[model samples]
Target: MTGTAKGMIGFDWAYCRALAVGVQDGIADEDVERWLPEARKVHERILKERESGLLAFWDIIEDEKVEERVLEIAEHFKGRLVDNIVVLGIGGSALGAQALFDALVSPFYNLTTRPRFFVLDNIDPLTFSQFLDMVDLGRTVFVVISKSGTTAETLSQFLIVKERVVSLLGREALKKHFVVVTDPDKGVLRSWVRESGVLSCDIPPGLGGRFSVLSAVGLVPAALLGLDIRELREGARAMAALCETASVIENPAYCNGLYHVIADLDKGKNIHVYWAYSDSLYSFADWLRQLIAESLGKKVGEKLYGPTPVKARGVTDQHSQLQLYREGPNNKIITFIGVKSWPADVDIPPAEEESLADAGYLGGKKMGELFHAEQRATAWALAEAGRPNITLWFPQVTPYTIGQAFFLYELQTVFMGYLYGVNPFDQPGVELSKKMTYGLMGRKGFEEFVRYL
Candidate 1:
């Protein structure tokens, strides 16, 4: 599990070693050793829970029935000429799909022969209005995703899109062009699926939206875009299996979780900054932000504790934020993500033989080399300044690697929750805000909150 392709991804905390007690604000080797048993205990508890069929997300990746169902539906539409694939979702529903599509597919995929993919995660009137104007309703396929079928943003978006689809393609075309992925038997979305007779998929009962990426929530969209959905699941399955073991050293998920929790609890470094060198991974970083923020940022009893999670794109953010990161407060634990190989590369054209002789060093290097070099420099510079950092190196940015990364972080954040003594699955704080919005909007039960506000 430590090799290039065999492991798919690697985590190195060597640079963080300098943060030992005497050197700087870092967790000592002895501390990591002390926490190893604690981490192992958490792992053991998770395994026990999983063994008794108590954990859904832990085993959701290996659900063959869901995979087969998703692929069956995907295969049915595999060869259909879809000019546009509109995904109507928000939060976990939309972010994971967008992250996968951006990371594995081409940046200019829509401009090319592939079907243009758009995830309407927001309800900006002008945005959806513009989208409706740009694509022909008849040739587009609408994927309306909402586990509850009652999410305000998603339902609103589906309504708007459904109207246009019915108006343009006629009422008969709704069942053909619309695909709904929600709860299998419950929720308003499911009722609509049955009445409309449209193709539909399940979000799996007990599966939280943020953690449902590997389920049909993510696979359906990935398959629709021609990505290797099975490979993605295989990658997640591999990581999940490795995580079942009690040894943190052998399990990247455990190791990641330990370091993040240790950095926050022991090192006083409360800000977790993720620096992704690949632009394709930037959205993946966004997905990470939501996972960490919503899951770990919580209060238990009389105490409140959670680290702030931040995202930065390497080489790009190097110019914009590196100065502050280097000279400003040392309250951040940075994780630098780098790709070992890119699918494509473009070397500098020898500086045109005469331009910027001082810049000649970059002449023979590929653009990717510069990207990698800047990450290395940033890590080195940060460590020199006594800033603790770690790296999650990917052998390549493919569906397999992306899938592995997704599980790795998901488990890590969950472990962080256990360490912080909070219920990671529930977001009561966010629900309060949702209640406020519902009340403000004249929802019956939330009227009290609206009046108070």
Candidate 2:
């Protein structure tokens, strides 16, 4: 089944293509072949670690308890006549949900029938004020997401909003306005939910924040936006089946990882540009940037190499950054994501005879053809310039494709982390800023700053 799917997707020769290209570019092609079997072994292990029941991939979806809880939360909000949903989170908690929402939902997402969903994931005071200004407190609902239940930025924002809601709608409004998603039985937020009588949901244990999107972390917003959460889960399940196979060349994740590893470790390309052809997918790029950076960035030995740089959504950026990419430094890898199909509602007519004569070019090609030509030309130019690049061609930007893409990149990141000898599951570097901020807030030793104040 996995082989059939790979063949259907034209991914059967990816490993061979990667190996051939790696050798031609004078990168360590032998390492790829030698590591191929090991990569497959590790991927299988990961699949087994997550497999349970009918879901071919991770057990998170198959867990009756988890699904029941998610549905309960959805029902709870649905029955309460909530009109607005404000999600308070940052990084993984926010990015995945926002990206999925933007991709799968309408631009005017809440036009008539659905509850409007808003994300407050950053710490911009102006933005928070703007959000508060727009919504009616009497009809709003807040979904607070913090795995630790004590993320300072998330908590700070939550407190400000909570206070405002209390002031406008009174203490009784708390039950109507708030629900918490945090660690199952831990964290300050969980305790607060218990004491304050706000409903609570659990972020699955052993699922790191970056990887929790398919879990309730992402699905809650997805449900609110009227997307088919079950289809997304099914797509993930399909991907999980692919990961179980023991052939590196046949596995999309393995081949992708091999390409990334060769580019970064062997070819000295440290920066990664995830360039997408469509404006709608810009959020997807941002979501992937966080996933790759947070998962792979780590200092090993005396060197300070991490996934330090990521740029996204090209064609527009082609005008701005293409010059630097082509002529500047040989320190980056470009990954192009192209959608192979479009809605029938969008169309562009061929050029007329007069227009063709003026331009001195072909007259009967579709506009999409021209755009794809430019993309192909850019790929050739980058390849000719000794810049390593890869392209992921999706059949279309539906939930199924998005699910496959997300899982593909995520699994690739895991393999890349293993190749780099870093623990992909934990992020220690993110804690540094949090600890420093707490210390600064505590007034424990601010004498140095006191003079300036």
Candidate 3:
């Protein structure tokens, strides 16, 4: 019983108006309008580069055969070789799959669905030991993802799993139990795949791990979970097509990023807080955090660019963080994500006790009504307190809307980078740490990095 089939997600900026939040807190159209020229240029650059192998994320579905192959592979694996699926990866490798699983799959998917899913994204020893005790080697298959094929956390875990599997079931088990997503031509994983004859997928070269969610990095795990990877592609494709223009007035990503640019440069709002109102969306919010922090938070020579990103859940964070957001420094901009229509709901029965009238006010209402009310109240309260905020609405959490969201935020981060005069793609700051870890682990060539540690 949805009101109407608007079928698209949208935003509400009324709370961000000067009339609502005051002149100092709210932004006029002119504030963002001044930033539009540069936004359009960035938009143009994205559109131009989307097909040129520079922005591979935009052209994720450019080849129809890619989905065809993904579906074929998914069909072969879902009902056949898989009864329990495990993903061995971290950061963008693991987060995209986790987000998609949490959002699109049932909350009790392991108990109800054919394949029980798990993502071992960390290296906690007890956690790994417990996971091994829980899974059946004969029925479980692993999706190992690493573009470079040598991520320390992921590779070490893979080594441990390999030894356990080999000792229990012999080396033959490796071919049947493991599937890899990595570089096509280079890296230790690629070489291992060629030698061991393991089933594998190629992560596109130009796409970084953070932006690789749309490629095989995300698609393989999605296929394993029996999700509609095609619909996900369609959603992203639709958003990408809609955002092909150079006008920030017409493009949602450019328009949204422009608002933030103005907030950062003109209003000194350096903290971007995202309040996701649903549990399913929390992982996506985390994905956005890494995307923003890694892509936009860079220093070239002497100047650092990019705002700090903060994430919170709706009613839960309201108790813990809302007080600070409401009364603390006015240097943060907040975005709330709300679901316009929920897939399920329960009606609250009328109160049995006469004196429990305080609680009885919520009787006979849909449970979602309270959830929606809390979000509405939070927005109202934030606005009244002159804290600038906006809501990004999802008609429902589907593969399409989720895809649209990932693309939107990725594009927005890119726009922020262009406006801030920084390269949003590479993360040079993270490389030194990787080198130091390798040296500390006694890898052959990185010994000099040990001194820094």
Candidate 4:
């Protein structure tokens, strides 16, 4: 097939090279490449396995039924005169979409135009109270998203907001006020939706919450905020095409994944520093942090290693963290993310002779030139310190670049998961805290906790 056709069909050669390099580095087995030709067979096996129901779930996500349901939710809100949308969700359900919303949408989109969007993903009482106090209940809509529909933080906030909506708009207004996006067949959320008469949408089965950004969990809020959902899909589709290929060197995802594997397996670099030059991408770092942490953190045989630690801090980190990074243990792989051209730039003219003499530096260098020089110096210093680094330079910061960047990381992460020999799609570790919190809450049933002073 032609490249475009093959890309559309999800064939990626670069990702295959990534898988191979990962294997050769002893991070995971080389058999991953052998499984490529039988990719469909492997997918079928995943669909049949009980634990692999996630595969079947994701398969149905692109189905007409799911898309139609998402559109319905969008239409329902669009039909109403809602002025605000408060999304109550936590962790995966909230973070990815929130990051995209914040990055891609104009700050003025909500304030001057359509329904303003606010995310209440935290259980902070003060923040929740402030949010409610600011929004007008008469024109506000609440979108409660929990893949399982029973997340305590979500449900608790939902209950609080529901009571307020009922009080201000009355019980009859509950239908107009609340909507749910969750698992269709299972979970207490479905039962609650049925009993409460709130509109509901399904969270696809195989797609884990973290990976559900392309699904309704993400798209619904995105659409509400006037984002181009098609572009988002096209970007993901493009990345998927990149992931399914055979040649590794040509794929950005494979190269990134291979570098990570080599850093961890060969160089014993366990920490991955994601250094972004933009302040806007700080949250993007957090999203990457979760993606890496949850995907490769499983115990394999006697070894319990996860994907290398992914930390997202700004270029400003050079002033502080750069010291330890340069002089400390050689256990980190620094990835520098830079934009080739910033939409905003300030040029500093040549300093006056007196000022130049006082500073003991060049008299005529522009401020931009000085900043670039400093960045180059830091990069050189790190290299001199024997610190391996990779630089991803973006042409500019736009939706297209952002989309491509997101997909690049996602593809690399998936390959990294495969290389680590762990189920990157599922996060069994997150349940521990949820279970603990529920046990402590004494809600509905279960054991009581004793508090010692």
Choose the strongest candidate by lDDT: 3
Off by over 4 Å in 2: 1-31, 37-57, 79-82, 108-114, 303-305, 350-366, 443-453
lDDT of 4 by residue, 1-453 (tens): 112432221122222132322333223334334434343343334335525454432344335565566677777777678888878998878877777776676556666876888888899889888887888988988888998878899999988888888888798898898878899888877887888888887786666776667677877787766677666666565555555554554566765676577667665778888776655566667777877888778877788867556555555788789999889987877776655555656655545667466664544555556555665676667766666666665555555555556666665676666666677777776766666677778754434421320
Q: Higher lDDT: candidate 1 or 3?
A: 3
User: Tens-digit lDDT track for model 2 on 68-90?
Assistant: 66777777767666778878999
Q: For model 1, how does the per-residue alpha-carbon lDDT over 1-453 read when each residue is reduced to its tens digit?
A: 253456478877877765422345676777688787677667777778779866667677878998888888878787787888879999999999999988987888888855789999998899888988888887888888997777988988888888877877788999768889998889888998889899999887777888878888888888877889888988887777666667777777777778778778887788999999898999999998889888888888878878898999988898898888878987888999888888799978666556578788888889888878878888988888888888888888887878888888888777778767787787788787888888998878988888667
lDDT of 1: 0.82
lDDT (Cα atoms) of all candidates against the true structure: 0.82, 0.72, 0.84, 0.67
The segments of candidate 4 whose C-alpha lies over 4 angstroms from its true place after superposition are: 1-72, 79-81, 106-114, 347-377, 448-453
- lDDT (Cα) of model 4: 0.67
TM-score of each: 0.96, 0.87, 0.96, 0.79
Give per-residue CA lDDT, model 3, range 1-453, as digits (tens): 111225566778778767788878788877776776777677677767765668867666666766776666676665575688889999989998888998897788889876888999999999998988888888888899998888999998888888888899898878888888998899888998999898888887877889888888888889878788888888887777777777676777877888787777788889999999998899888888889999999898898788999999988999999999999999989999999788899999998797887788888999899999999999999999999998899999999989888888888888888889999998998999999999999999999999985
Better candidate by lDDT, 3 or 4: 3
lDDT winner, 1 or 4: 1
Task: Sort the candidates on TM-score, descending order.
Answer: 3, 1, 2, 4
